[model samples]
Target chain A: MKLSKSEVEHVAKLARLELSAEEADRLTTHLNGIMAHFEKLQQLDTEGVAPTSHVIPMQNVFREDVTGPCLTAEEALANAPESSDGYFVVPQIVEV
Target chain B: MTEYEPVIGIEVHAELLTNSKMFCSCPVEFGGEPNTRTCPVCLGLPGSLPVPNRRAIEFVIRASLALNCEVKEYSDFYRKNYFYPDLPKNYQISQYDNPIGRNGWIDITVDGTVKRIGIRRVHIEEDAGKLIHASVGNESLVDYNRGGLALMEIVTEADIRSAEEAREYLVNLRAILTYIGVTNGKMEEGTLRCEPNISVRPKGTEKFGTKTELKNLNSFRAVYRGVEYEVKRQVEALQSGGRIIQETRRWDDDRGITIAMRTKEMEQEYRYFPDPDLVPMNFSAGLIEEQRSLLPELPQARKERFMKEFDLSAADAEMLTSTRAMADYYEEAVGAYPDYKGISNWIMGDFTRMLNSAGIEIDASKVKPVDLAGLLKMIADNVISGKMAKTVFEEMFNTGASPKEIVKSRGMVQVSSETELYPIIDQVISENPRIVQDFLGGKEKSFGFLVGQIMKYTQGRGNPQAVNQLLRKRLSETKG
Candidate 1:
């Protein structure tokens, strides 16, 4: 499927990124190449054939029901851009 | 409008119970400080190389065999390129071309009917860091404490017909996973997650309609309700001649609605390619059989055994075997005392009721298996009447004392000897002359009152069965 220039811009906007014109152009060519590869898969007959999504066959993957450790307040906030008493601080969220 | 058929698929992410991260020796513990559990390997730092955890791969084989999936002799992991703060490497090391398992089915019971849901594949992958939205002005902060944990993505074919079937599928899947000791299957902590790709068509058409994926459903109830709401939303859109857009939606559990998050990204957009950093993997037959041997008796088999060996009803067996802990408790109790029916009654009746009321688990209770068995044995031996047995059991739960000790300390033994109760009975007969006359005058019910009086005089320790028989015999002899 060929994506118009406008569609590429729309998708970038929805993803919350400010892409420059040159970046959008580069992404368009790269995405187009990727979509071209999928065109090969579409050519294969799949009338009743199931779509191959995963390679390994597994069922009932489970874990034991037990609780372990959690991160401490200091460690959780260590990488915060900003912080306050035992919490990650950020810019004020609201205005009256 | 043309008729359409709904097609559904499920993608489940289950966290494996490995002691360490997939590629690093860092401990795989939940709820750690940001970046504390991280090392050079997990952070995708320069000079880091990935090493496979043999235990994790073995567990994958065990799970694959349980699901009846075929294991590829040669398989490998690939890089799924993406950019997000949660994903520090901007790409996830996932299985792209070949996964660990493929083509399996799980049997689930939906509304008293058994249905098989096809599993597409189960592949190994790394988990992303949790993003905590601090709701700061115009932006949300992110936390990387949980980044790079090991997880398996189990995707299912679009074969589910209803939300009820989806719930059953999850339950059965969780049970099997728990039985195999792979993932903890804990939804509260995000150990097991279900993302359902749901679409609705007219009741009988063959073509699938456009579907939306619902995410962030943490519980089974949320999944069912979310799917139901999505179905209704799609159905109404089709009826109104509006197109159903392909998108990803967030499940609002508080409001019970599936809100669209963003437009669904097509597979082509991710630009998936084989990871060049890792080599293709292979497994021998010996590896697969090794995992198979470690398997324990699963819930279905245990349920059948409960019915045949313990004579438990289907409902009782299902309740007892709900978890490994509860099943083990029941087995231990039965092992101590071979009275299967007696243990079942105590477990299903008072023990379960007490556990529920006290808001504690069976394993956490002060009562032990041997103590309960001993209590039941006392009742079975007629040393304590059933009524007195209940009292002793409660005291046993509170004090952790043996039932024999309680009975001995409280003088609760039933007075079964006739000589032991003869004096009390004679006094009751002489004092209650009017009642005795009424019994002889064809008022046979008065004999019951006489027996009660005798029991009261003996402080309820009189043998109830013997007292009834002696009272009836004495009253009949005086009738002449």
Candidate 2:
């Protein structure tokens, strides 16, 4: 399926991405090409094949609830642009 | 105005008391120095993978079984995508479809009628960081210590009809969760959080009005008041020919009203999908039965057992079984002493008052069950009068001392012997000649006055029964 300009913009917005008009157009063509490849594969689907997220049969991977180690506050915030009072400071949020 | 009914469904997010974080080994704790518990995995640094916590999953399973839910055989984890600074990762690891537990119910008695509120699902997820806004700044502070803590979200169906019912349902739900050793279920400390979505429908109408979700319900009273205020606000809006908008509302505790939040509900969309980093958990029959067997007798069953075993009334059994520690305390104390009803009276009356005033629970109490039974034994053994035990108990509560020690240190033993009490009784008889004369003249109430004087003279340590019999003998001899 071909994605319209608005659909491309909506996807970018959901991803919090800012795309210029030229960038949107170029991505749209690339996305359509990827969709065409999927369409060709869609025609070759076997009826009895099961859908899967992983190739191998793997489940129930777990870790014991024992605590090990944690980074100091300074080390944790080492890469952040700003921090104060042992906290990561950000602009006042507008969240629901 | 047309009559309307308010519909409410509550959602609870309780932090699991795991020793470590959900996907990492960082310690999970509350109220530590900011950012002290962060790691590469929880802080969302690149190239770090998450392994699920076995104990955390078992905690959720325990709670689900206690709530009478059907534990699913297959469960998958998903990432709920959103934009929030508190979330180090933009998407929170959650369970979107095929939650671990579903279709459960808990019974709450509101207005003397038992009703089963439906539990839609109980899913596990990670908690976001805490945000504290500076009073005068344009920035907010975030503490990641609470981040990545395992949280279990229990969503209830729209079965509540009033604010009171909503409060009762939460009370009953918290009891069950805390009883099964899953979470602390502390709302004030923010370990347990409740959000109620409310809507109002006009009488005889088949459609529901637009609903609003409420936030900042930190206590049961707040839940009651917040829901009550929202119901009234919606009913008033409909009565004024104004339509309610579907949005999130903040409960303004100071102003005591629900104000619409600035964020538009339409803008908040969580596109959920299965997280590729984590694998799905397929429960075996043995595994599910293991969790189910770990489940203890829940609050309801224990309450019934208490009534039959302890021979307690409905209210007494309910109060005793309010918390697991409390019920255990009662049973242990009764085991020490066979006076069941007498122990119940002390726990429900003076013990609870002392605990409430001290702002502690039975588990944190300084007075142990054996200590209380010891205090009662002092009275039964005639070492101290019932009246003298009150003073001894106050000292015991403050110092956690033994009843014998308190009585000894305070010099408050009961004077039961004739040799010890005869002098004080004689002194009272002579000092109150008017009362003695009144008794001789057939004023029967005058004898009670004489007994009071002797008790007052003895500093309330007089054995009341012994003092009564001796004073009667002395007064009759005076008449002869």
Candidate 3:
């Protein structure tokens, strides 16, 4: 149930978050506290309880395969931080 | 060097042939102006929710049923979090714990042995956008038009042991998917993509070695070559006392090698959780039955039926039933003319050659079933010789003209009557007295030369059978 500093750093890296040493150490303690609380909760006898992914009981919520309106290229790229030739520009990606 | 056994399994991702995107109403098309097919939901704009496409789900079910997968009654979508430029949402909605179908199997014939490869699971997911990198610099462009498109991932058990088996597995899988009308199954267009995880082990070892994944394999040939290269690389590494590392490798098709992309530690841990926006799917018995009924006869079954009913060889049956449209064309032509082998020959020979050369489907061609049947009937009734039929077919293919019309207009009718060919035969004999003397002097080739001359004199419209008979009679009468 203990959350280590390296685990926090790894998680941050996966989320594309750049965390300093101080922040990583602080988050480790904070996350460990949260994990301890969850561990305490896990100790209760709830073996028969059904696992629920969502609180809502909705099932088979689907839309028909009919196309509606779509955004123009200008509108789609309007909010992009950087765009060129109707495309969102990013730094060169070395790996896929 | 010790012999090693390689274990290979493939993961195929196919885009569903739906009218709209997976979670939005944007049209799901292959190519257009970049970013034009985007909507708020697909672009991952703030506060937008995703709604599943019904047809896409049905397509997954149909594919699962066709592959002999047990369709699950309950399935839910999960969000797999990752960071990539193509994934605008920073996550992909996919199935994790409960996929739509599981425990399926597909049978592929490798080296004349039927091997049943187990299907682990078939899940539905959304495709990310495409990234186009600039040729010379560290700059890339993203197009979200393909974002949020419906994709079905089919995972197979590690049953394949060779590159040829992997290729056969993909071929059969593509045929089945195309037959069910779920996906177009065009690998070249990037609709169907395959990745194989391969590992090598000592010949008698029961445990698997560290496996490396081959990615971005676009064609069956690429899959075959990629697996072959990876297996050999792994085997060589083991032989040199080098440890194998689990990693992701890209198939350098031009260079024909598997280049290391990233190590296992650098791989994303796709922290998956249930997406709160979309609800779970619960299939009713009626619904599953309806979807099952919608499944047409798949490729394997149709091939067997063709062999049984038409009395075709395995190769002929397989070639004729390669595609659904081709199979239907064959059936329709056979219905019109009851000569199974003749129809099979024409379809498998000239028909397929023309299709491959023109890069078109059978339905897209000008040659209709009736036209083909007419051509075959002409050949059967001796109205035109087989050699002449080839020319007539080309004319019909180019002009869309009927076989009868082409024959009549081009004066391609065979001269079969004895009364008509007798004088021509007599003239040929008199004109080619030297050849006649050569024939009388027991030169066997002179007969063929005279027949050629007679055919040339008749403008290639002579009935070869009658010409052969009459020429023999005339030569013998002169000899007597």
lDDT of candidates 1 onward, in order: 0.77, 0.90, 0.91
Residue pairs in candidate 3 whose N, alpha carbon or C atoms collide under 3 angstroms? none
Report the lDDT tens digits of candidate 2 across residue range A1-96.
Answer: 778888888888888899999999999998989889998998995899866655557899999999998999999889987899899989876543
Cα displacement (Å) at residue B4, model 3: 0.6
Per-residue lDDT value at B424 in model 3? 90
Ranking by DockQ: 3, 2, 1
Each candidate's clash count: 18, 0, 0
Score candidate 1 by DockQ. 0.10
Q: List ranges where model 2 is wrong by over 4 Å.
A: A44-50, A94-96, B264-266, B435-449, B472-480
Candidate 1, superposed: residue stretches over 4 Å from native: A1-96, B1-7, B31-35, B135-141, B220-243, B249-268, B353-366, B394-401, B409-480
Model 3 misplacement above 4 A: B262-265
Distance from true position, residue B390, model 2, in Å?
A: 2.0
Q: What is the DockQ of candidate 3?
A: 0.79
lDDT of 1 by residue, B183-226 (tens): 88877679999999999877777778888888988988988888
In angstroms, how far off is A55's CA in candidate 2? 4.2
What is the C-alpha lDDT profile of model 3 across B149-244, one tens digit per residue? 999999999999999999999999998999889998989898999999999999998999999989978888999999999999999999999988
TM-score of the first chain alone, every candidate: 0.79, 0.89, 0.90
Across B1-480, the per-residue lDDT of candidate 2 in tens digits comes to 699999889999999989999999999876778999999999988999999999999888888888889998889899999878899888999998888889999999887789999999999999999988777678888888988999999999998999999999998899999988889998888899999999999877878778999999988999999999999999998999998898889988888998888874248678898899999898888987898898778888898999999899988898898889999999999999978898999999998999989989888988889989988988888889888988888888888898988888889889988998999989998898988999999999998999899899889899989999999999999889
